[model samples]
Target: MPQLLMIEDDARLAQMVGEYLEQSGFVLTHATDGKAGLALLEAPTAAGLPDLVLLDLMLPDMDGLEVCRRLRALPSDAARLPVVMLTAKGDPMDRIIGLEMGADDYLPKPFEPRELLARIRAVLRRRGEAAPSARIMRFGSLEIDRDARTVTVAGEAREITSYQFDLLAALAERAGRVLTRDQIMEAVRGRELEAFDRSIDVHMGRIRAAIEADPKNPKRILTVRGVGYVFARQQD
Candidate 1:
Protein backbone atom coordinates (compact mmCIF):
# COMPACT_ATOMS: atom_id res chain seq x y z
CA MET A 1 0.00 0.00 0.00
CA PRO A 2 2.29 2.73 -1.24
CA GLN A 3 0.93 6.19 -0.45
CA LEU A 4 0.69 8.73 -3.28
CA LEU A 5 -0.28 12.39 -3.42
CA MET A 6 -1.74 13.94 -6.56
CA ILE A 7 -1.96 17.70 -7.01
CA GLU A 8 -4.38 18.21 -9.83
CA ASP A 9 -7.20 20.73 -10.39
CA ASP A 10 -9.36 18.47 -12.53
CA ALA A 11 -11.82 16.64 -10.32
CA ARG A 12 -12.94 14.13 -12.92
CA LEU A 13 -9.39 13.29 -13.96
CA ALA A 14 -8.30 12.92 -10.37
CA GLN A 15 -11.20 10.65 -9.51
CA MET A 16 -10.60 8.50 -12.56
CA VAL A 17 -6.89 8.29 -11.91
CA GLY A 18 -7.42 7.57 -8.22
CA GLU A 19 -9.69 4.68 -9.04
CA TYR A 20 -7.25 3.22 -11.56
CA LEU A 21 -4.26 3.61 -9.26
CA GLU A 22 -6.10 2.11 -6.29
CA GLN A 23 -6.88 -0.91 -8.38
CA SER A 24 -3.15 -1.34 -8.77
CA GLY A 25 -2.75 -1.39 -4.94
CA PHE A 26 -1.73 2.21 -4.32
CA VAL A 27 -3.42 4.48 -1.78
CA LEU A 28 -3.87 7.98 -3.15
CA THR A 29 -4.36 11.31 -1.35
CA HIS A 30 -5.81 13.96 -3.61
CA ALA A 31 -5.09 17.70 -3.44
CA THR A 32 -6.96 19.88 -5.87
CA ASP A 33 -4.39 22.68 -6.03
CA GLY A 34 -0.73 23.45 -5.47
CA LYS A 35 -1.12 25.16 -2.09
CA ALA A 36 -3.08 22.33 -0.58
CA GLY A 37 -0.62 19.84 -1.95
CA LEU A 38 2.32 21.75 -0.53
CA ALA A 39 0.59 22.07 2.82
CA LEU A 40 0.01 18.35 3.06
CA LEU A 41 3.62 17.62 2.21
CA GLU A 42 5.00 20.29 4.55
CA ALA A 43 3.05 18.89 7.50
CA PRO A 44 2.78 15.14 7.66
CA THR A 45 1.57 12.86 10.44
CA ALA A 46 3.33 9.99 12.18
CA ALA A 47 2.57 7.85 9.17
CA GLY A 48 4.98 10.13 7.28
CA LEU A 49 4.79 11.76 3.86
CA PRO A 50 3.57 10.20 0.66
CA ASP A 51 5.97 7.87 -1.13
CA LEU A 52 5.64 9.83 -4.38
CA VAL A 53 3.90 12.88 -5.83
CA LEU A 54 1.89 13.13 -9.05
CA LEU A 55 2.06 16.86 -9.68
CA ASP A 56 0.08 18.55 -12.44
CA LEU A 57 1.58 21.49 -14.33
CA MET A 58 -1.56 23.60 -14.19
CA LEU A 59 -3.04 24.38 -10.80
CA PRO A 60 -5.68 26.80 -9.53
CA ASP A 61 -3.43 28.52 -6.98
CA MET A 62 -0.04 28.37 -8.71
CA ASP A 63 1.58 26.83 -11.76
CA GLY A 64 2.98 23.31 -11.34
CA LEU A 65 6.48 24.47 -12.18
CA GLU A 66 6.37 26.89 -9.28
CA VAL A 67 4.94 24.19 -7.08
CA CYS A 68 7.79 21.89 -8.02
CA ARG A 69 10.34 24.57 -7.21
CA ARG A 70 8.79 25.07 -3.79
CA LEU A 71 8.70 21.36 -3.21
CA ARG A 72 12.40 20.99 -3.92
CA ALA A 73 13.15 23.90 -1.60
CA LEU A 74 11.67 22.00 1.32
CA PRO A 75 14.07 21.62 4.24
CA SER A 76 13.33 17.99 4.99
CA ASP A 77 13.87 14.78 3.04
CA ALA A 78 10.48 15.53 1.50
CA ALA A 79 12.50 17.62 -0.95
CA ARG A 80 13.81 14.35 -2.37
CA LEU A 81 10.40 12.77 -2.79
CA PRO A 82 9.95 11.27 -6.23
CA VAL A 83 7.88 13.58 -8.47
CA VAL A 84 6.16 12.75 -11.77
CA MET A 85 4.86 15.81 -13.55
CA LEU A 86 1.64 15.76 -15.57
CA THR A 87 0.80 18.39 -18.14
CA ALA A 88 -1.44 18.89 -21.15
CA LYS A 89 1.21 20.95 -22.88
CA GLY A 90 2.83 19.06 -25.76
CA ASP A 91 5.92 21.23 -25.74
CA PRO A 92 9.05 19.31 -24.82
CA MET A 93 10.43 22.49 -23.30
CA ASP A 94 7.89 22.29 -20.48
CA ARG A 95 9.00 18.76 -19.75
CA ILE A 96 12.64 19.80 -19.89
CA ILE A 97 12.00 22.65 -17.48
CA GLY A 98 10.23 20.32 -15.10
CA LEU A 99 13.26 18.05 -15.04
CA GLU A 100 15.41 21.08 -14.32
CA MET A 101 13.08 21.87 -11.42
CA GLY A 102 13.79 18.42 -9.86
CA ALA A 103 10.93 16.31 -11.18
CA ASP A 104 11.77 12.61 -11.42
CA ASP A 105 9.55 11.96 -14.42
CA TYR A 106 6.99 13.62 -16.74
CA LEU A 107 3.72 12.48 -18.30
CA PRO A 108 1.58 14.32 -20.80
CA LYS A 109 -2.20 14.50 -20.50
CA PRO A 110 -4.59 12.14 -22.34
CA PHE A 111 -2.14 9.39 -21.54
CA GLU A 112 -3.21 5.83 -20.90
CA PRO A 113 -3.63 4.87 -17.26
CA ARG A 114 -1.36 1.88 -17.86
CA GLU A 115 1.47 4.09 -19.02
CA LEU A 116 1.04 6.29 -15.99
CA LEU A 117 1.16 3.30 -13.69
CA ALA A 118 4.27 2.01 -15.42
CA ARG A 119 5.98 5.35 -15.07
CA ILE A 120 5.12 5.57 -11.40
CA ARG A 121 6.46 2.09 -10.81
CA ALA A 122 9.59 2.87 -12.77
CA VAL A 123 10.30 6.00 -10.73
CA LEU A 124 9.64 4.24 -7.46
CA ARG A 125 11.96 1.45 -8.47
CA ARG A 126 14.75 3.90 -9.07
CA ARG A 127 14.10 5.62 -5.77
CA GLY A 128 14.19 2.33 -3.89
CA GLU A 129 17.38 1.05 -5.50
CA ALA A 130 20.46 0.88 -3.24
CA ALA A 131 23.78 -0.27 -4.50
CA PRO A 132 24.47 -3.92 -3.80
CA SER A 133 27.91 -2.97 -2.54
CA ALA A 134 28.54 -0.43 0.18
CA ARG A 135 31.05 1.45 -1.90
CA ILE A 136 31.64 5.16 -1.44
CA MET A 137 33.56 6.80 -4.26
CA ARG A 138 35.46 9.90 -3.25
CA PHE A 139 36.82 12.54 -5.58
CA GLY A 140 38.48 15.42 -3.74
CA SER A 141 35.83 17.10 -1.62
CA LEU A 142 33.00 15.31 -3.44
CA GLU A 143 31.67 11.97 -2.29
CA ILE A 144 29.11 9.65 -3.87
CA ASP A 145 27.81 6.97 -1.51
CA ARG A 146 26.01 4.47 -3.68
CA ASP A 147 24.96 2.34 -0.73
CA ALA A 148 23.29 5.28 0.99
CA ARG A 149 22.21 6.99 -2.22
CA THR A 150 23.57 10.25 -0.92
CA VAL A 151 26.09 12.78 -2.21
CA THR A 152 28.26 15.09 -0.14
CA VAL A 153 30.81 17.77 -0.89
CA ALA A 154 33.57 18.37 1.67
CA GLY A 155 31.41 16.60 4.28
CA GLU A 156 28.39 18.83 3.49
CA ALA A 157 25.38 16.96 2.15
CA ARG A 158 23.97 18.00 -1.22
CA GLU A 159 20.44 17.52 -2.52
CA ILE A 160 19.85 15.76 -5.81
CA THR A 161 16.80 14.15 -7.33
CA SER A 162 16.82 10.37 -7.64
CA TYR A 163 17.02 10.58 -11.46
CA GLN A 164 19.91 13.01 -11.31
CA PHE A 165 21.72 10.79 -8.81
CA ASP A 166 21.44 7.87 -11.18
CA LEU A 167 22.75 10.00 -14.01
CA LEU A 168 25.67 11.14 -11.92
CA ALA A 169 26.36 7.62 -10.75
CA ALA A 170 26.26 6.40 -14.32
CA LEU A 171 29.04 8.83 -15.21
CA ALA A 172 31.04 8.30 -12.03
CA GLU A 173 30.82 4.52 -12.33
CA ARG A 174 32.56 4.81 -15.67
CA ALA A 175 34.99 7.52 -14.70
CA GLY A 176 37.23 8.87 -17.48
CA ARG A 177 35.01 7.39 -20.21
CA VAL A 178 33.16 9.69 -22.61
CA LEU A 179 29.56 8.63 -22.95
CA THR A 180 27.07 10.08 -25.41
CA ARG A 181 23.58 11.13 -24.36
CA ASP A 182 22.12 7.94 -25.76
CA GLN A 183 24.69 5.87 -23.93
CA ILE A 184 24.16 7.75 -20.70
CA MET A 185 20.39 7.30 -20.93
CA GLU A 186 20.87 3.61 -21.56
CA ALA A 187 23.16 3.30 -18.56
CA VAL A 188 20.53 4.98 -16.41
CA ARG A 189 17.83 2.56 -17.63
CA GLY A 190 15.78 5.61 -18.64
CA ARG A 191 12.67 4.99 -20.73
CA GLU A 192 11.18 8.47 -20.46
CA LEU A 193 13.26 10.35 -23.03
CA GLU A 194 10.75 11.28 -25.73
CA ALA A 195 11.38 13.63 -28.67
CA PHE A 196 14.05 15.54 -26.67
CA ASP A 197 17.56 14.28 -26.22
CA ARG A 198 18.74 17.48 -24.58
CA SER A 199 16.97 16.30 -21.43
CA ILE A 200 20.28 14.66 -20.53
CA ASP A 201 22.00 18.04 -20.68
CA VAL A 202 19.33 19.49 -18.41
CA HIS A 203 19.91 16.75 -15.86
CA MET A 204 23.67 17.10 -16.12
CA GLY A 205 23.39 20.80 -15.38
CA ARG A 206 21.41 20.06 -12.24
CA ILE A 207 23.89 17.44 -11.09
CA ARG A 208 26.69 19.92 -11.59
CA ALA A 209 24.79 22.53 -9.61
CA ALA A 210 24.61 20.15 -6.68
CA ILE A 211 28.15 18.65 -6.64
CA GLU A 212 30.36 21.07 -8.53
CA ALA A 213 32.00 23.96 -6.68
CA ASP A 214 31.35 26.08 -9.74
CA PRO A 215 28.79 24.68 -12.15
CA LYS A 216 29.78 27.34 -14.72
CA ASN A 217 33.15 25.65 -15.19
CA PRO A 218 32.66 22.09 -14.02
CA LYS A 219 35.95 20.25 -13.39
CA ARG A 220 34.43 16.95 -12.30
CA ILE A 221 32.17 16.39 -15.29
CA LEU A 222 33.68 17.63 -18.53
CA THR A 223 32.07 17.95 -22.00
CA VAL A 224 33.71 16.41 -25.07
CA ARG A 225 32.60 18.98 -27.63
CA GLY A 226 30.68 17.10 -30.35
CA VAL A 227 31.02 13.88 -28.37
CA GLY A 228 29.48 13.23 -24.94
CA TYR A 229 30.81 13.83 -21.41
CA VAL A 230 33.35 12.17 -19.20
CA PHE A 231 33.87 12.27 -15.43
CA ALA A 232 37.36 13.45 -14.59
CA ARG A 233 39.03 10.82 -12.42
CA GLN A 234 41.12 13.52 -10.80
CA GLN A 235 39.43 16.53 -9.26
CA ASP A 236 40.91 19.56 -7.58
Candidate 2:
Protein backbone atom coordinates (compact mmCIF):
# COMPACT_ATOMS: atom_id res chain seq x y z
CA MET A 1 0.00 0.00 0.00
CA PRO A 2 1.18 3.55 -0.75
CA GLN A 3 1.95 5.72 2.27
CA LEU A 4 0.69 9.31 2.55
CA LEU A 5 1.57 12.23 4.81
CA MET A 6 -0.90 15.07 5.18
CA ILE A 7 0.04 18.37 6.77
CA GLU A 8 -3.11 20.06 8.01
CA ASP A 9 -4.05 22.05 11.05
CA ASP A 10 -7.68 21.02 11.00
CA ALA A 11 -7.70 17.93 13.16
CA ARG A 12 -11.25 16.95 12.32
CA LEU A 13 -10.69 17.33 8.63
CA ALA A 14 -7.48 15.32 8.78
CA GLN A 15 -9.22 12.56 10.68
CA MET A 16 -12.02 12.47 8.13
CA VAL A 17 -9.64 12.42 5.17
CA GLY A 18 -7.30 9.89 6.76
CA GLU A 19 -10.17 7.53 7.46
CA TYR A 20 -11.54 8.04 3.99
CA LEU A 21 -8.17 7.27 2.37
CA GLU A 22 -7.54 4.32 4.69
CA GLN A 23 -10.70 2.66 3.47
CA SER A 24 -9.34 2.96 -0.07
CA GLY A 25 -6.16 1.00 0.83
CA PHE A 26 -3.87 3.95 1.59
CA VAL A 27 -2.06 4.44 4.89
CA LEU A 28 -2.17 8.13 5.75
CA THR A 29 -0.22 9.78 8.53
CA HIS A 30 -0.91 13.27 9.80
CA ALA A 31 0.99 16.30 11.08
CA THR A 32 -0.82 19.24 12.63
CA ASP A 33 1.59 21.92 11.38
CA GLY A 34 4.29 22.55 8.83
CA LYS A 35 7.26 22.41 11.19
CA ALA A 36 6.45 18.94 12.48
CA GLY A 37 5.73 17.82 8.97
CA LEU A 38 9.08 19.13 7.78
CA ALA A 39 10.78 17.47 10.69
CA LEU A 40 9.16 14.18 9.92
CA LEU A 41 10.20 14.48 6.29
CA GLU A 42 13.77 15.53 7.07
CA ALA A 43 14.34 12.43 9.13
CA PRO A 44 12.01 9.77 7.90
CA THR A 45 10.80 7.21 10.38
CA ALA A 46 11.05 3.42 10.18
CA ALA A 47 8.47 3.51 7.41
CA GLY A 48 10.66 5.84 5.35
CA LEU A 49 9.28 8.84 3.50
CA PRO A 50 5.69 8.72 2.37
CA ASP A 51 4.99 8.25 -1.32
CA LEU A 52 3.23 11.62 -1.50
CA VAL A 53 2.49 14.71 0.56
CA LEU A 54 -0.91 16.40 0.88
CA LEU A 55 0.17 19.91 1.83
CA ASP A 56 -2.29 22.57 2.95
CA LEU A 57 -1.64 26.13 1.81
CA MET A 58 -2.37 27.68 5.16
CA LEU A 59 -0.18 25.99 7.71
CA PRO A 60 -0.08 27.32 11.29
CA ASP A 61 3.73 27.52 11.37
CA MET A 62 5.65 28.15 8.17
CA ASP A 63 3.43 28.91 5.20
CA GLY A 64 2.78 25.99 2.91
CA LEU A 65 4.51 27.78 0.04
CA GLU A 66 7.68 28.11 2.08
CA VAL A 67 7.36 24.51 3.20
CA CYS A 68 7.09 23.41 -0.40
CA ARG A 69 10.17 25.40 -1.38
CA ARG A 70 12.10 23.84 1.45
CA LEU A 71 10.80 20.44 0.60
CA ARG A 72 12.14 20.73 -2.92
CA ALA A 73 15.52 21.86 -1.55
CA LEU A 74 16.08 18.67 0.42
CA PRO A 75 19.34 16.92 -0.50
CA SER A 76 17.75 13.52 -0.83
CA ASP A 77 15.30 11.53 -2.87
CA ALA A 78 12.61 13.09 -0.72
CA ALA A 79 13.22 16.30 -2.63
CA ARG A 80 11.47 14.77 -5.61
CA LEU A 81 8.55 13.60 -3.50
CA PRO A 82 5.20 14.25 -5.14
CA VAL A 83 3.00 16.94 -3.56
CA VAL A 84 -0.70 17.79 -3.87
CA MET A 85 -1.69 21.14 -2.46
CA LEU A 86 -4.92 21.46 -0.52
CA THR A 87 -5.98 25.07 -0.59
CA ALA A 88 -9.08 26.90 0.60
CA LYS A 89 -8.34 29.72 -1.82
CA GLY A 90 -10.25 29.58 -5.11
CA ASP A 91 -7.93 31.99 -6.89
CA PRO A 92 -6.24 30.44 -9.88
CA MET A 93 -3.07 32.23 -8.81
CA ASP A 94 -2.96 30.04 -5.75
CA ARG A 95 -2.98 26.94 -7.88
CA ILE A 96 -0.44 28.40 -10.27
CA ILE A 97 1.88 29.43 -7.48
CA GLY A 98 1.54 26.02 -5.90
CA LEU A 99 2.49 24.38 -9.17
CA GLU A 100 5.44 26.71 -9.55
CA MET A 101 6.42 25.93 -5.99
CA GLY A 102 6.61 22.19 -6.87
CA ALA A 103 3.18 20.70 -6.20
CA ASP A 104 2.16 17.87 -8.50
CA ASP A 105 -1.54 18.80 -8.22
CA TYR A 106 -4.05 20.87 -6.24
CA LEU A 107 -7.58 20.44 -4.86
CA PRO A 108 -9.77 23.16 -3.44
CA LYS A 109 -11.16 23.01 0.06
CA PRO A 110 -14.49 21.47 1.07
CA PHE A 111 -13.85 18.85 -1.60
CA GLU A 112 -15.67 15.56 -1.59
CA PRO A 113 -13.70 12.67 -0.14
CA ARG A 114 -14.21 10.89 -3.42
CA GLU A 115 -12.58 13.74 -5.34
CA LEU A 116 -9.65 13.76 -2.94
CA LEU A 117 -9.26 10.04 -3.33
CA ALA A 118 -9.37 10.39 -7.08
CA ARG A 119 -6.67 13.07 -7.04
CA ILE A 120 -4.46 10.96 -4.80
CA ARG A 121 -4.83 7.91 -6.98
CA ALA A 122 -4.12 9.85 -10.13
CA VAL A 123 -0.91 11.36 -8.78
CA LEU A 124 0.39 8.07 -7.40
CA ARG A 125 -0.48 6.33 -10.62
CA ARG A 126 1.53 8.81 -12.68
CA ARG A 127 4.57 8.64 -10.43
CA GLY A 128 4.58 4.86 -10.26
CA GLU A 129 3.79 3.70 -13.78
CA ALA A 130 6.63 3.31 -16.28
CA ALA A 131 5.51 3.33 -19.86
CA PRO A 132 5.73 -0.01 -21.66
CA SER A 133 7.69 1.79 -24.33
CA ALA A 134 11.44 2.32 -23.85
CA ARG A 135 12.16 3.14 -20.23
CA ILE A 136 14.78 5.78 -20.98
CA MET A 137 14.06 8.25 -23.77
CA ARG A 138 16.91 10.35 -25.10
CA PHE A 139 16.81 13.35 -27.43
CA GLY A 140 20.30 14.69 -28.03
CA SER A 141 21.38 16.09 -24.65
CA LEU A 142 17.95 15.81 -23.07
CA GLU A 143 16.94 12.54 -21.46
CA ILE A 144 13.62 11.38 -20.03
CA ASP A 145 13.77 8.27 -17.85
CA ARG A 146 10.28 6.84 -17.51
CA ASP A 147 11.32 4.21 -15.00
CA ALA A 148 12.93 6.72 -12.62
CA ARG A 149 10.54 9.51 -13.61
CA THR A 150 13.34 12.02 -14.14
CA VAL A 151 14.55 14.45 -16.78
CA THR A 152 18.10 15.52 -17.46
CA VAL A 153 19.61 18.10 -19.74
CA ALA A 154 23.19 17.40 -20.83
CA GLY A 155 23.54 14.85 -18.06
CA GLU A 156 22.47 17.32 -15.38
CA ALA A 157 19.15 16.71 -13.67
CA ARG A 158 16.58 19.42 -14.21
CA GLU A 159 13.91 19.96 -11.60
CA ILE A 160 10.29 19.64 -12.70
CA THR A 161 7.10 18.65 -10.93
CA SER A 162 5.54 15.26 -11.53
CA TYR A 163 2.75 16.45 -13.79
CA GLN A 164 5.06 18.75 -15.72
CA PHE A 165 7.47 15.86 -16.25
CA ASP A 166 4.62 13.76 -17.60
CA LEU A 167 3.68 16.54 -20.00
CA LEU A 168 7.24 16.81 -21.23
CA ALA A 169 7.42 13.05 -21.68
CA ALA A 170 4.23 13.09 -23.70
CA LEU A 171 5.61 15.74 -26.01
CA ALA A 172 9.07 14.23 -26.23
CA GLU A 173 7.67 10.81 -26.95
CA ARG A 174 5.97 12.27 -30.00
CA ALA A 175 8.72 14.61 -31.07
CA GLY A 176 8.04 16.68 -34.20
CA ARG A 177 4.32 15.97 -33.85
CA VAL A 178 2.12 18.98 -33.20
CA LEU A 179 -0.22 18.04 -30.39
CA THR A 180 -3.18 20.30 -29.80
CA ARG A 181 -4.01 21.58 -26.31
CA ASP A 182 -6.79 19.02 -25.99
CA GLN A 183 -4.46 16.25 -27.10
CA ILE A 184 -1.77 17.32 -24.68
CA MET A 185 -4.24 17.37 -21.80
CA GLU A 186 -5.51 13.96 -22.79
CA ALA A 187 -1.97 12.61 -22.90
CA VAL A 188 -1.22 13.54 -19.32
CA ARG A 189 -3.26 11.94 -16.58
CA GLY A 190 -4.47 13.37 -13.20
CA ARG A 191 -6.54 16.38 -14.43
CA GLU A 192 -8.53 17.61 -17.37
CA LEU A 193 -8.20 20.97 -19.08
CA GLU A 194 -10.90 22.98 -17.34
CA ALA A 195 -12.38 26.30 -18.54
CA PHE A 196 -9.88 29.17 -18.58
CA ASP A 197 -7.17 26.58 -18.89
CA ARG A 198 -3.65 28.05 -18.85
CA SER A 199 -2.24 25.16 -16.83
CA ILE A 200 -0.70 23.56 -19.88
CA ASP A 201 1.08 26.73 -20.94
CA VAL A 202 2.31 27.36 -17.43
CA HIS A 203 3.67 23.84 -17.20
CA MET A 204 5.23 24.08 -20.65
CA GLY A 205 7.00 27.29 -19.71
CA ARG A 206 8.38 25.61 -16.62
CA ILE A 207 9.53 22.63 -18.64
CA ARG A 208 11.32 24.84 -21.15
CA ALA A 209 13.03 26.65 -18.33
CA ALA A 210 14.35 23.34 -17.12
CA ILE A 211 15.39 21.80 -20.45
CA GLU A 212 16.10 24.63 -22.83
CA ALA A 213 19.28 26.64 -23.05
CA ASP A 214 17.15 29.75 -23.38
CA PRO A 215 13.55 29.51 -22.26
CA LYS A 216 12.68 32.79 -24.01
CA ASN A 217 13.46 31.13 -27.33
CA PRO A 218 13.08 27.42 -26.80
CA LYS A 219 14.48 24.94 -29.33
CA ARG A 220 13.21 21.78 -27.66
CA ILE A 221 9.52 22.60 -27.52
CA LEU A 222 8.13 24.85 -30.21
CA THR A 223 4.78 26.65 -30.13
CA VAL A 224 2.44 26.74 -33.12
CA ARG A 225 0.36 29.88 -33.23
CA GLY A 226 -3.38 29.19 -32.71
CA VAL A 227 -2.65 25.48 -32.52
CA GLY A 228 -0.40 23.69 -30.03
CA TYR A 229 3.22 22.65 -29.40
CA VAL A 230 5.76 20.22 -30.82
CA PHE A 231 8.96 18.97 -29.25
CA ALA A 232 11.95 19.30 -31.55
CA ARG A 233 13.24 16.02 -32.95
CA GLN A 234 16.81 17.23 -32.59
CA GLN A 235 18.41 19.56 -30.08
CA ASP A 236 21.48 21.81 -30.31
Counting clashing residue pairs in each candidate, in order, gives 0, 0
> Model 2: what TM-score?
0.56
Q: What is the C-alpha RMSD of each candidate to the true structure, in Å?
A: 16.6, 16.5
* Per-residue lDDT over 1-236 for candidate 2, one digit per residue giving the tens place of the 0 to 100 score: 57799999999999999999999988888999999999988877544568799999999887899999999998765788899999898999989999999999999998999999999889878876743468898887989999899998889999999888889998877665567788788887565444544768988999999999999998788888787887766546
Point out where model 2 deviates above 4 Å: 130-236
lDDT of 1 by residue, 30-96 (tens): 9999999999888763334688999999898899999999999998657988999999999999999
Worst 10 residues of 1 by lDDT: 188-197
lDDT of 2 at 117: 91
